[model samples]
Target: MKKVCKGLGTVLVLLVAIVVIRASGSAQLDAPKAPAPLSVQPSESAERLGKAISFRTISHQDLSQVDTGQLTGFHQFLRESFPLTYAKLTVEMVSEYGLVYRWQGSDATRSPILLIAHMDVVPVDPGTEKAWTHPPFAGEVADGFVWGRGTLDFKQGVMGIHEATEALLAEGFVPKRTVYIGLGFDEEVGGVLGAKRIAAHFAALGLKFDFVLDEGLAVTKGMMPGIDSPVALIGIAEKGYLSVELLVEQDGGHSSMPEKETAVGILAGAISRLETTQMAAAIDGPAREFFDTIAPYMPFGQRLALRNLWLLEKPLTWKLTQKPATNALIRTTTAPTMLEGSVKENVLASRARAVVNFRIRPGDTVQSVLEHVHAVVDDARVKVNPGEGAADPSPMSPSDCWQFDLIEQTIREIYPDAVVAPSLMLGMSDARHYAPVSEHLYRFAPMMFTDQDRGRVHGINERIATGEYAKVPHFYAQLIRNSSLD
Candidate 1:
């Protein structure tokens, strides 16, 4: 009996020891993974793309003129235009206008990839149609490009991607992994009903992607003064936003005999302090990674300056943050957007309120920003409240992996003369919604834009160059072809 009892005790101790070793092994295995490589081509069918651009599918803030009927026509147009894509791929609809298509691959073990673009364009201004050299919805093929609103903002992406898929299908080229195309209907107006609902659809199906590509940055010339080549900026992340309202209440009295500190006076003082004591600018996150990638492409002297960013980052950030455009890249920015006070012109009493909008940097939070505002406007009478406009900054994506390198190499193959660089997007996009689950989220619209073309994005005379328009579809095709599951 004694011998049996001793044997049982030894076996129990061994089992516990094995369990501890297995737990430790699992913890260590969860290290960060490197991004995958992408394979891309540069040739596209431009003639077909021009025809696809002719459709007049526009999105408006007012739901009345949205024209769901036009959207249906546009969908039909896609089917008739790209017969190969419609026949081969599986399509799903998230809502009335939102579309998602999946191109299956040979291997199912590898995670799927998503390419996203919105199909809707903002409504033309009340009388800006005449300002356009070609009508906003004309989709004319003049001056070697397509002239239209959606041509620049997004229709280009939609048409280009579909055209690429169609061409690839013709060549019988198959992807090693599954590729998904997610199209939103209302991106210009926050994409709440469109992209937000689409995200929920993916979540319900337990579909997690390796990466998602969307529109944000583009290739630009003279972006960097010394660099001669056009730089292709791939957005790794975007800033957060919030609107804070400061209010001060005072007893009603005659304007002729007001108190020493009137309600308006108190509000003005708070605004001044908040503007003067802006958030501290820091060099970190995706913004710093952006400079690091382009450093090698820069002149030796400039490269030296960028390579030693750790030491020079603080001073460089402080100086850049002083300018309006450069300032947006470094820290949270504040702008006094709206102000409200008394009801009548003669009355100068009661309550005064001012609305300040803020675009927050990556590391900061809404709570931390609010605390800073309170500290800056150190007045007992002034009360700060969260305004309607507020959104936390999107999470930053990693750039060190093969996913970013693939984007750089693909752009190089097509526009051999252009330089590729990472960037921090100043504005928000539907891309933000996918960042939480995706390892790599890139924002790039593979189209060429000149100085004048840049202004047309949300302004008048929007159009894309003819030669460049033809290459847009080819860029998408190359990106899809270059990507492999291995």
Candidate 2:
């Protein structure tokens, strides 16, 4: 009887092992498959895009330096370049720099789609002209590249969308749903006058869009290792900006005679403490979704690492959020940007202040971040204050919805080799303004760029490949046609 009982126990253990093995195998099999490749048709009207890049509508940090006449020239260039688009669409100027064009569709009951891009480019630093392969604003076409400043940062979107719309109009194709194109003039300085005004205009008109697509992410090769395809990041949300000032005050005296802890010393110590006790990192929101979507494309080790994210989230977050680029992905980051103290070298007088800039992550509030800093510094002598009109992190859009799936499908059609992944944009854009009103707001510029091309954006020798110039517009056209209200 004892031997029979032992035999039954061994059989039960083997059965349990088999069940676990099958469950593991099933989970592996359920992993997502790589999306289908994108098929692109090269644009015949690529020359017009080269001409569009010639305008020098650069936005300066100092508003007074902006050349209004140059912007006017750009407006004229748009009018002359795409005659079909101008003739077919109804264009309206919102503010001095904001341009919005509305194309009437066959079905008005279906929700409209808004395509956004900025017309302005950031000012090139003084005395960097020598580095360019061609002149920055010369808009030279050489070696199958369109060399200019706005070629990548934006104007590519401007021209690409226009070119696509024009091409569709030429082909006598009418969209099933209403299509709106918004071009902001002051994106570099902040879209307050441009995109903000446009959003206000739409709000006042009681207009709501189904989805709005703007410039944010791009398709990149080798961005995700172990994934053979290029990772095309789609910005589902953006980080918030907050400038915190830490002020410390103490008794002043001559340099020869100083207190044990001076104002400057106290401020520096507080800054150091805050830096060492950095914000806690935990993967959540769009960033977590991003990794999950691409996990199947990764190697077996990386797949396992990503699959168990929920279980291993604490350690993974700590490891990934230490670096600037990766940290920007998970939690809010604080950087001590500016310092102010006594004017004279010899006089160690009263007060010292440090301005620390924070890029707040989603799910993080300005109040919460400030509280964390206060706890870390633990200095009663120091006072922490908020900066000018700091915006909180924008709300995240849904990844499981059809809106995102449509975007991923469009990208796959445009760049078949690229894998669509969600990402959190560290910098701000006009897309943030629309988040409150629109259900689905995405940030992505469908232009193919290599590492060198990416660097050129807002840098010296900015340029876009001619091949990309042609492909991007077609991608926009495809997206417009493919997207349905349902």
Candidate 3:
């Protein structure tokens, strides 16, 4: 009994020590430092972006569906809008449509900094055309918003980069390090023919980049519950993609008298099992790194859980999985996108097929995803085959480097209220193609987006606030000048 009492006392003391240490750490997060103010006129910036959105450079999965004329017209529009940029930088076309621009710097030894954005946007859903407040292709500027498909998903980046260059050139600002900008045409459909070819061109020339920046996460507002201000997420790594075809074959017979378990039934059961037994959820990897960066600003209770991660990992993961957005950050997500079985209502089809798509997380591979699917299904009757697109997880870039610090500093200068953190990009981007040429690749768009605005991307009534759209050019200009000037 005495020993038991002693052990209890020791445990109490340990708990008290943990509380004290966590309280000490919380003090460091109490005050968030704001960067210097960014100054710019919003109306003038929105005019150029609105005009850029007028050209419907939509990229379809079927290359034949894309009208190449629209792409050419868009290129012409850019040249006419930014004459100063055309005068300063040398621009060339790759793969007939993709654009690459070079701005020579004073120093020849330093590797160039690459800025990339896609010119193409996803097509509006065919039947849902009438649902938009402003037509998807209209480039309408009304109600303090620039409404269009590409306004958010990426036309902002394309126009913003050019605007920044034109502004800098007008002021006679030249970079000390070479700068390269790549505007890809088919990023919406995997960028294979666009960014892939341009990356090859750079690789063939034996060119290396000091760092690469591409469109990704933005300054998101109201994402974290306990934290009020915006969180600026910078993607240091991107998840991979894989699609698998699950086919089941069985003997066909009349619908009036059929076997107890048909092909359709078997496939349905397998899919259900796979969904129920998902890959384990975790709070480690880049997700953990994200929480560590923002933990200091969170409320006391939230900070306690993040600070004492070792004791609360399971609970934290459970909390994260409750939200769809946060859930994808920690685990490889699986969704059964397509399924086909019977041709007629009265027929018992001999073969049934289903397509399951997976966004593979870092530390997980294409092979591992297949292995898990097979193990969970556990049926020799069903055969699994690789589908069209399959890519292994990408390598993680360094978070602690001169390039990252420069990005952080630039963000502070533009958005003083944002809390910056490194994140794992759950969606696909053209940045993946440039991984081989650059050791440090960071993905961020430097724009403000609310949760509703996030839903608008690839959805109806897509738009960007005129005021927010204007800040993008300023952000890029600061990033370029700060990183290269000295």
Q: Which is the leading candidate under lDDT?
A: 3
Model 2 misses residue 61 by how many Å? 5.8
Please write out the lDDT profile of model 2 over residues 52-155, one tens digit for every residue.
66777888756678888888888988998789989989998898878999999898788888999998988778898888888888877888878878888898
Ranking by TM-score: 3, 2, 1
* Superposition TM-score, candidate 3 onto the true structure: 0.96
* lDDT on C-alpha atoms for all candidate structures: 0.78, 0.81, 0.87
The candidates, ranked best first by lDDT, are 3, 2, 1
RMSD from true fold, candidate 1: 12.9
Collision pairs in model 3: none
- TM-scores of the candidates are 0.84, 0.88, 0.96
**C-alpha lDDT (0 to 100) for residue 479 of candidate 2:** 84
Clashing pairs in 2: 38-413, 38-416
Better of 1 and 2 by TM-score: 2
lDDT by residue (48-136, candidate 1, tens digit) is: 54555566667776667788887888888889878988999998888778998999988889888889999888888887778888887
Off by over 4 Å in 3: 23-41
